[model samples]
Target chain A: MLKINDLHASVEDKAILRGINLHVKPGEVHAIMGPNGSGKSTLASVVAGKEEYEVQSGEILLDGENIDELSAEERAHKGVFLSFQYPVEIPGVSVTNFMKTAINETRKAQGLKEMPANEMLKMIRQKSELLEIDRKFLSRSLNEGFSGGEKKRNEIFQMAMLEPKLAILDETDSGLDIDALRIVANGVNKLKSEDNAVIVITHYQRLLDYIVPDFVHVLYEGRIVKSGTKELAHELEAKGYDWIKEEVGV
Target chain B: MSKYTEDDLREELKTKEYEYGFYTDIESETFPVGLNEDIVRAISKKKEEPEWMTEWRLEAFRSWQEMIEPEWANVHYEKPDFQAISYYSAPNSKPKYDSLDEVDPELLATFEKLGISLDEQKKLAGVAMDVVVDSVSVATTFKKTLAEKGIIFCSISEAIQEHPELVKKYIGTVVPQKDNFYAALNSAVFSDGSFCYIPKGVRCPMELSTYFRINQAGTGQFERTLVIADEGSYVSYLEGCTAPSRDENQLHAAVVELIALDDAEIKYSTVQNWFPGDADGKGGVFNFVTKRGLCEKNAKISWTQVETGSAVTWKYPSCVLKGDNSVGEFYSIAVTNNYQQADTGTKMVHLGNNTKSTIISKGISAGKSQNSYRGLVQVSSRAENARNFSQCDSLLMGNLCGAHTFPYIEANNKTAKIEHEATTSKIGEDQIFYCNQRGIDTEKAIALIVNGFSKEVLNKLPMEFAVEAQKLLEISLEGSVG
Candidate 1:
């Protein structure tokens, strides 16, 4: 569903991702693991078409089409979703209204009529039930004064509403407790199908315990040093990233 | 989600055009650009006012000549040439129309373009209206229904000729002739405005509204609105205005006063959408007006205004809480776009025991415009246990626009409790990105964010006006951000 080759990205003249490469196929989960500042989140951001990062030399493809020229919103309209690390707080726009606008806008971009009000409400009800979100919470302003877990859950809730083909979970599990982690991972696991995929970017293996990955790539110094099976995650958990840093020789 | 650039969106909005710029082909009697005692006398004579009214206008004219225009507001614009503006202009037709059918067809067409068609306005049936074209009232609707309830609703000119006793007792009582430069000018040569009076111990059964439009090219609009809620009475009054598009700047200086007697309550709202010049601010309305209200014992008064259209605006609607246990409220949302400049706020004076007041002001500045909220909350010594809470927030759309808050508070009572809070924020790229990531484009994102920012104040407007105000905010902020 997604492909990145020779991905060299930087922000403000400082190189972050140097010659990184990854291929995400449908019905499969890819876990990218790296220590702090090792360009793990940067990779997720680049894949989602964040404007801050400059692609010094790289190309990205979505479903075999070059997406390097697409804007963040256009990428989203083409079924790319990024769960932000720190969601913004819009004080007076309720979560429900925000979701309605997002859903309708995406539909509009695809040349579809607006969803009927009753169907929209039913969809909201079913999705909120799947995510264990309160109706009252859905009426509150988007992420304003929301707890860390609530923010992550709301992000996932939006992801569920959009049903993007390629979902990049960028540090979505760091701020969540074990219960919220279970709920979030459960939501992702349920939504996974043969036509969609997810890339979980995290520093630890905690989230992997809930949603096991098909492959694990250990990244060191902005390059994927090792690619292996799920056993590599437990191995990395046993030996910290320092061991990997030594293996890569700085 | 439009694929257009911010500049494209701005162009689309500019094409929205000053919808009221269309002129009506009608003969008008106009005065030359100058103000003197003779001009004031001529206006009064044209209205056929009684002797006392003419003398009072002359006195106001003398006071206006001695007063200097204020320059303390946080706005910069070329001072208007008052001597070059026609003081009075009226459609050379009958002053009063017995029915909507008798009104000029072109004048009625103007109202239709403004979205308050005369037929629809009358069909609403729940609202009584005083429709003023240029400087004279052409029709006062639902007079018979209002009069049956001992409620007097008519043009100020008709009020003077019919109910001289009440008009004399209230005119210039709340906002005096020498109160301010613009107020004095309005009092001197003001042509026509709405006058509403509710009897003692009666609640007005329907809404009373006045629509003011400036049709002639060079004439300014100076209307006076007075609303009196007698003892234990209640009323809600609404005023809205528009002006035709012109390259030459027009001036709108008016006075509005309200009086609430013991146990009475008055609520006044204004949706001012005068022409807000072209993108370069070549020409538009310069709105300088004074509005004030007085509350007697156990009375309450509230002012709610949504100001979105004016090249330059200087207005402050205030309240004087003179009655014990009286309440005062000011809820406003002022939007300035392109080169428009607005300096608006409210003043609350708590002079009676146990009085209270609340102020919520929201200012949105976009497109190199400047918007400011200057408010004052004063508590006198006799105002024991007086309380006031004020919240002023500003939202900036781009780096070039500006938003300022100047709050002045005076407390002399030992038991007075006052709280003031303010915040200023910008539309950050991150917020826009968040929305974009959810599939909303920058233009819709900005509109959503702005509407959210101004929701608190917009919620206070009447339903019909609230929707219109919300749409206005969206249009004003378009292309403000890229």
Candidate 2:
């Protein structure tokens, strides 16, 4: 579903991701875990085509097509979604209206008619129910004064609405409590399909417990140091990232 | 339901022509450059004003000659060459027309393009419209219906002729002739505007409105609007303006005065879309207006405005709470894009006991424009228990634009309760990316963000004009700096 070869990215003059090569086939869930200063989040951001980051030397292919030149919005129209850790607070724009704009814009880009109002409403109702989001919550201003859990849940709600082919959950679990984590994890699990993929980037293996991954890669010093199956997450959770840092030997 | 492609929309936005840019091809009786008592007398005589009206205009002309233009606003522009602008220009046609069909084809076409044709407006049910072209009113609709209800709605010129007593008693009563330099000039040589009067205990069943169109090349448009809500009456008046595209800046100095007598209520709304100059800030309207309302015992006055046009806008619609338990409110959203500049707000003067006032102002600055909100809230010594609440928020779209606020509050009565809150926010790149990541383009995202930022003030507009104001905000900031 997604392929990155020698992904060397930098923001400003500082190199973040030195050399990253990763491949995720369809229906695969990959978890990338690293300590605070590692390039885990940077990898997610680079793949999503954030313009601030310079892809110094990299090739990102989506379905075998080079997407390096695509804009963030274009990437989104091509079924790439990023669930921001900190969703923007757009006061006075209701969540429903924001989603409407997003949906219509994507449909417009794909040369499709706008979803009928009733269908959109029904979709919102069914999807929001999947996340246990109150109906009134959908009418409030988009993330303005929303609690941290609500913001993360809203991010997942948007992810559900867009139903992207490749979803990047960048630190989506950092601000969630136990119940919110369960709800968000459940929502993502229900949306997973053989034709879709999710790249989970987290500091701790805590989120991996709720949304188990098919594979785990230990990222340290801007490169993947180890790759293993789901037990690697349990091992990292039991021990710590210190073992990997020591193994990399600075 | 939609046929436009994104390319077509982009092409249309690229042209960005002033939608109301067509100039009427009519022979106009215009005055030559210069100003004096003779010019004022000529304008008054042209309107066939009553003797008292003529005398008041002469007095204003004398006062204007002695007044120096104030320079305290936060806008930068070359001072206009007042001596070079024609003080009066009116279409060479008769005053009264029986129906919209009788109006000149060219003049009617102008309104049609503006989407406010008399027939369309009459179909709007309860809106009485006075269409002012250049410096004279060419169409007045729903006058008969309004008159039958003891409501006076007509051109100021016609009001001076038919309801001279009301005009004489109310003109300059709220915003006096010498209130400011522009007000003095408008009082002196003002040509025509809408005049509305609601009789005692009578609630006007319609929205009294006027559409001022500046068509001539170099003629200045001086309009005077007066609305009076007599004792225990209620009225809501709305006015909007547009000007033909001109390379050289045109001057528009208008004065609006409103009076709400005892137990009366008056609501005034304005959607000002004067021609903002070209991208380089070459030609546009220099809009300098003075608007104020006087509230009597237990009366209420509210001013709601959406200012999205003009090369340079300097207007402060204010309220004077003069009687016990009176109230005042100001809700505004001012947008300045390109090289446009605006320094507008309101003044609430509390002179009566327990008088209350509320102010909400939102300013959006894009491109290299500058937007400022300058307001004053004053509580006099005897205004015990007077209360005022003010909120002013500014949203900056690009790094190049500027937003400023200057709120002056003076409380002489120790018992007065005054509170103010203000915030300045930037349209962060992350915010834009958030929308982009959701598949919305930059243009549509910006329009959504801006509309959201000003929703509070936009909500205060009349039902029909809110949609127009929202569109104006988008068009004004279409191709912004960022």
Candidate 3:
């Protein structure tokens, strides 16, 4: 579903991702765990086509097509999604209106008409029910004074609305409590299918417990230093990243 | 990230042209360029005014000659050459129109181009429209419907001749002559505007709107709008102005006076889109307007304005709460882009006990423009328990633009409760990236954020006008970001 070859990226001439190579097929979940400032979020943002990070020497492919030149919005239209670590607050714009605009813009880019109002409302109702979001929550300003859990849940709500082909959950569990973590992980588990993929980038194995991954990779200083199955997460969580740092001869 | 920096956004902002820049082709009777007592008298005489009206203009002209233009506003412009401007210009033929069909086709086409088809407006919008072109009221629609309800809606010239008692009773009462430099000039040489009077205990059946268009070249448009709501009455009046593109700046000095009698309520809204200069700030309109309303006992007055165009704008819509328990409200959204400069806000004076006022102002500055909010809240000694709440916010796009706030409060009565809040923020690139990642482009992203910022003020507008204001906000900021 997605491929990255020698993905070297930087922001403002400060190198972040030195070299990254990854391949993920449909119907699979991949977990990329790293210490703080190890380029995990940078990978997600670069793949999402954030213009601030220049792809110094790399190529990203979606369905065998090079997407290095695509803009963030274009990537969005092509079914790429990024759950932000900290959602931007847009006051006075309701969540429903924001989703409507996002959906309509994507449809417009794909040469499709806007979804009928009734269908959009029905979808909103169904999706909010799936995520256990209150009806009134959909009418409030987009993340403007929302609690941390609400913001993460709202990000997932948007992800559900877009139904992207490749979803990158960047630090999605950073601010979630136990209950919120369960709900969010449950939502992500239900959204998984054979035709889409999810890349969960996190700093701990706590989130992996709820949404089990097919494979785990340890990112150190921008490169993947270790790759293994789900048990690798528990092992790393038990021993901490200091062992990995020693193994990498840092 | 760095590829689409603030410099790129500023460059893109310079390419946007004024949307309503097309000039209308119509022959006009233009007065020669100059300003003097003789010119002022000629304007009054040309309107066929009564003796008192003519004398009133002469007096205003005398006061104007003695007063110098004030430089206190947070704006700098090459002072306009008042003597080089033609004070009066009107369509050569002013034919009495019994129906919309009898109105001149050229004038109707002009309005149609402005998206205000009088025929459509009369049938659909249920709005009584007084269309003023280059200083003369060309067409007045729905007069019969308004007249049936004992509502007096007509051109100021017509009102002077037909309802002199009402016109004489209220004209210049709120913003009297010598109130300011521009007010004196407008009072001296004002040609024509709408005059509406809601009868006692009558609610106006429809919105009273006046659309002012400056079609002729080189002529200054000075319009005087007077609206009076009698005791126990209510009215909503709308004023919209647009000017054709010109290479040299044109002057527009207007005076608006509103009176809400005891137990009456008046809502006045203005969507001013005069010609803003080109990217290099070579031409546009100098909009200097004086708008004030007086609220009597138990009366309420509200001013809502969405100003988006003009090279230099100096306007303050104010309210004088004269009667006990009266209310005053001002909601404004001022947008400046490309070299535009706007210094606009409101003044609320509480002179009676328990008078309350609310002011909400949102200023958006893009490109190299400068937008400022200057407001004053005065609580007189007699105004016991007077309350005022004010919020002023500014949003800037690109690093070259500027936003400023100057709020003045004078509380003579210690019991007065006054609160003010203000904030300034830039349109962060992160906000844009967020929207972009959601499949919205940079342009749409900016528009979305701007609309969100202005939602509070826009909500105060009438439904139809609110939609128009939203669209105007988008158009004003289009291409303002890369």
User: Judged by DockQ, which candidate is best?
Assistant: 3
Error of 2 at A250 (Å): 3.7
lDDT of 1 by residue, B217-243 (tens): 888889899999999999988887777
Give the 10-residue window scoring lowest on summed lDDT in candidate 2 chain B: B1-10
Model 2, DockQ value? 0.45
Q: Is 2 or 3 the stronger prediction by TM-score?
A: 3
Across A1-250, the per-residue lDDT of candidate 2 in tens digits comes to: 7999988989887999988989998899999988887888788878877767888897999999998888788899999999887789999999999999999999999999999999999999999998888999999999999998999999999999999999999999988898888888898899999999998988778788888899999888788889998899988988898988788887
Q: What ranking of all candidate models by TM-score puts the best one first?
A: 3, 2, 1
RMSD of each: 2.6, 3.5, 1.2
Question: What local lDDT score does residue A201 receive in model 2, on the 0 to 100 scale?
Answer: 88
Candidate 1: stretches off by over 4 Å: B1-21, B98-101, B480-482
Q: lDDT by residue for model 2 over B1-482, one digit each (tens)?
A: 01222333333333465667777798888899899888889888988888899999999989988999889999889999888989989888865688766777877777777877688788885788888888788877788888888988888898899988888878988888888899999999999888888989998988888888889999999998888899999998888877788999999999988899999999999999999987677899999999999999999999999998899999999999999999999999998877899999999999999999999999988777899999999999999999999999999875667999999999999999999999999877788778878888777887999999988888888888888888888877665311
The positional error of residue B81 in candidate 3, measured at the CA in angstroms, is: 1.5
RMSD of 1: 2.6
lDDT of 3 by residue, B1-482 (tens): 34666777777778888888898888889999999988988988898999999888888899999999989999999998999999989897787678878777887777877898877887877877888888788777788888898999888889999999998888889998989999999989989888999999999978888888888888888889899999999999988877779998888899999999999999999898999999998899999999999999999999999999999999999999999999999999999998999999999999999999999999999998999999999999989999999999999999888999999999999999999999998888898889989999888988899999999999999988999889899888887553
The candidate 1 chain A region of ten consecutive residues with least summed lDDT is: A44-53
